[model samples]
Target: MRRQKKTILLASPRGFCAGVERAIEIVERALQKFGPPVYVRHEIVHNKFVVNELAKKGAIFVDELDEVPKGATVIFSAHGVSKSIKEQAKIQNMFAIDATCPLVTKVHNEASRHHRKGRHTLLIGHAGHPEVEGTMGQVPEGTMTLIETLSDARNFNPPISDGLAFATQTTLSVDDTSEIISILQHRFPEITGPSGEDICYATTNRQNAVKKLAAKTEYFIIVGADNSSNSKRLVEVALKFGAKNAVLIPDANSLKLNELRNVSVVSISSGASVPDILIDEVLKKLDQEFDISIKIESSIKEDVYFNLPPILRTR
Candidate 1:
């Protein structure tokens, strides 16, 4: 029987944003400099593959500061931690290295500035996400309110209307966040916001690439961890942009042949935290099942790069 022909459209700028790259590098460098059993406050990034790889290199993942022995080294996750966590690290006397992405750090700084200026801040993000939790912790408990949906934005009534400001999780859906921001602006005309859009450039570019690919592909697959916000957003963006079917898979191993049996034309992309090696795995798997033709669709060229922490610079 003649094998069926399938076209796989791959989105460019699909995996490992500059921030994720920097975070992983920090962990690897820390392991080399400080020796094994270097404690990490959380998963350096959201991907299981990434965490597992780092673990093999002598990194220890812990949920809280209490887990670390006094005088040991600790590194914070790419999702920035709150003020309290910083204070705790200092008190514990742990040699702490911040692996938080520079972009997320920017949002944290904005939140702190807003609080200092007495602005009743509103954060547009999903509840319980590490990034959201970390950002919220930047200010006093009651100072920042979380606005997760359009309904939340509509019903929100600030105690002091004139002193309102807003900041958002760096990985949120650009389109969805815009709607919430729009609603907030409508309700509170005096509300202040960050000088620029909080969504990172890599996120916006990846989403834009997926949006274009979704229009032409019959089915879409987003390769990323379930907990990763940007990866999940790409799945949503694909479905919203017109793909017939879209799903989030952790890696190439997660794909079911049955799902792609009817999908003649498919598009594949990975979340920001994903490594390109996973994307290659998926492509290899697809090639085995069908006579595949590959096309690379790049929406934009990303030239952004972030440097490692200052402590690692001299190493």
Candidate 2:
């Protein structure tokens, strides 16, 4: 009797979005240019493996700006930063490098534009997320409100005009965000919006690929840290798309054999911050545990590259 082969479908445009790439490059270049003890305001990106690797190279991660010594080089996380954070950096006389994703910075600029135009803004994103916090901080505390659900949109009242505009976190659920945006538009028909979708192309492509592959896959696995919103979204999208079992394990060590007990087809993807090396590790473990075959189901090809900051431009 021949054993049945388990098929694994790999999603393309899965790991390391453009923003994450830029953020990581910023840190690496800073290390090369300035040498060791370079301070980072937050995890440059959320993946544990990336953070640990950078830490090994003397990149110091701190939650607060005060932790950074005067004159030390501090790099902001890809999620952007609050106005107060930039002010504090200046006050402390620290040399700062912003690694905030360009897409996120666009939303921040939109928030400021809306506030300047005397229009109250509704920020659609998860609360307490660094991106959300940083975007909301673009304006005064009372100038904008955070809306996480349709209910928030339903009850939200703008202090200024009904002709409101909105922005979102670069990493968010494409489907869920659309529904929330619909609710906002239904409530305020005069609401203004940006010409382009707020979520980055990499995030959308990954989720779409997961959604397409999950239906045919018995089990779905996402390689990313627990703190990664985009990584978590991939798991949720997979589950929603009909995968019997879906999980987000940081790496191979976190995978459980039981999850694959009856699973004959597996789909895999990684978050924006996650590195391909982690995915490769998981693949190696899967190869040892099961008779697996590989398939590539790519939704789109990604060729986006963000330029390094001016300081590292020559490098």
Candidate 3:
């Protein structure tokens, strides 16, 4: 008997957002310019495959600045970093290159500005996430409070209600963040927010793409790392929007063969940090098991790009 046929809704605007592209390229370029053993402060963009590939090319990923020798080169991850981290690097006289997503840098700046004006900031994201930590640290200790859920949004009594502001991680569930923002805004009518959404363009685009196919898709597979906030949000969005089931797998081979047994229509999307080759492996795996018809369901077109750091150009 012939293998069963399946239809795949391949989400466009998925994988390798401009920031991730820039981050990975920064690593590769740094290696080229400096030769082997250049230090990177963290996993460049949270993708294991990307990290492994870079590691092979002489990028040394360390958890902290101390791991890098004094006055040696180091690159910050795309998630951005705290003022303390930057200051530490400066103190150590390390030649640091910032690979932070400019979008994330924007949030940091916005939160800091709120502090300069004396408004206590409610950072809307999970605590301890590098991005959230960096944003929280932009202002002094008591100036920024993290709001991770509806309860956090509801119960926190600000030092004073008069001055209030909010900023969010670039990677988050759009619907969930909106609800949290609504709760906070409703409670604090005068609260200030970004002139536009803090959630980055790639994140919003990927979530919207998943939403467009969730109802018709029987199963959804989000190709992204477990620690990747935006990728996990894609899984949640698929399940909430109407897909029968959804999961986040880091790679093609990590997908369970059993999960595909009953699904005739599937949707696949990747997080902003994912590389296209991972998605390709998933397609190849799917093709081996079934006669798959793939369609590109692009909710939007993304033409964004971020340039490599200037230090990469310096001798």
Candidate 4:
């Protein structure tokens, strides 16, 4: 019996965005400089593999500031955290390092700036997401409103419509967010928005790459954690762009080979938070079961880099 032949289209700019790299490096460097048992406020990133690897290196992941012992160095996750969390850390006197992505920080700053200018801010993002929580928390409780869908945007009636502004989550689907934004802007023509889009370049670039690959592939697999917002968006983008089938797999281990049995050409892309090694593992597994030919499909080349947190710089 002959092995089935398959073509794998690999999306570039697919894994480990600069923000994630910095966040992981922050934990590693903190562990090295301060030694083991360093506390991190949340999973440094959404990926369990990355968190587990950091754990082995002596990082302790916790849910809140109260869980951390007094005076212990606690790092914020890449998702950012509330201003109250910072106040609580200060009250507890815990040495704190913020590993929030610079892109996320930008949204926080936008919210704060909008509030200072007396504008009622609207945050466009999924509810309960860490970044959304943090961004919304930047201003007074009632100053910002959360708009997760087009319906929310359409129904939102700001206390003062003339003084409206909006910010967004960095990891949202570009197309979906645009639709929501369009609805809001059409309703409130005077509403102000960020100078540039709130979604980071990494999220936009990865989606673009996947969209190109999805058009030519019979099936698509997105390698990322279930909790990763950007990863879920990739699956939706692929399916929306014409891929016959699309699924999200945390890693190669999660893949159901049967789904690909009839797929002559499959496209693979990883979320911004995923590591390249996971994608390599998936490729290796496919090679063992089928005659595989890999092709690189990239819509753009990303040259973005974010520096490690300043405190880690001295070490």
Compared with the true structure, model 4 gives a TM-score of 0.98
In the range 1-315, model 2's lDDT, one tens digit per residue, is 444468999998799999998999899999999999999988999988888899999899999998999988999999999899999999999999999999889898999999888888888899988999999889998888888987888888778755588888888999999988988888888888876459989889999999998878888999888889999999999999998888999999999976686778988999989888998999998888788899888889999988888999875
Candidate 3 has which clashing residue pairs, if any? none
| Candidate 2's TM-score | 0.97
- Which scores higher on lDDT, 2 or 4? 4
In model 4, which range of ten residues has the least summed lDDT? 188-197
Candidate 3's C-alpha runs over 4 A off are: 313-315
The TM-score measured for candidate 3 stands at 0.97
Sort by lDDT, best first: what order?
A: 1, 4, 3, 2
In order, the Cα lDDT scores of the candidates are 0.92, 0.89, 0.91, 0.91
Write the residue-wise lDDT of candidate 4 on 28-84 in tens digits: 999999998999998899998899999999999999888999999999999999999
- Per-residue CA lDDT of model 3 for 167-274, tens digit only, reads 999998988999999998899989999865599999999999999999999989999999999999999999999999998999988989788987899999999999
Pairs of residues at least 3 apart in sequence or in different chains that clash in candidate 2: none
| Candidate 2, residue 204: lDDT | 94
RMSD from true fold, candidate 2: 1.4
Count of residue pairs whose backbone atoms collide, per candidate: 0, 0, 0, 0
lDDT of 1 by residue, 53-154 (tens): 999999999999999999899999999899899899999998999999999999999999998999989999999999999999999999999999999999
Span of ten consecutive residues with least summed lDDT in model 2: 1-10
User: TM-scores of all models?
Assistant: 0.98, 0.97, 0.97, 0.98
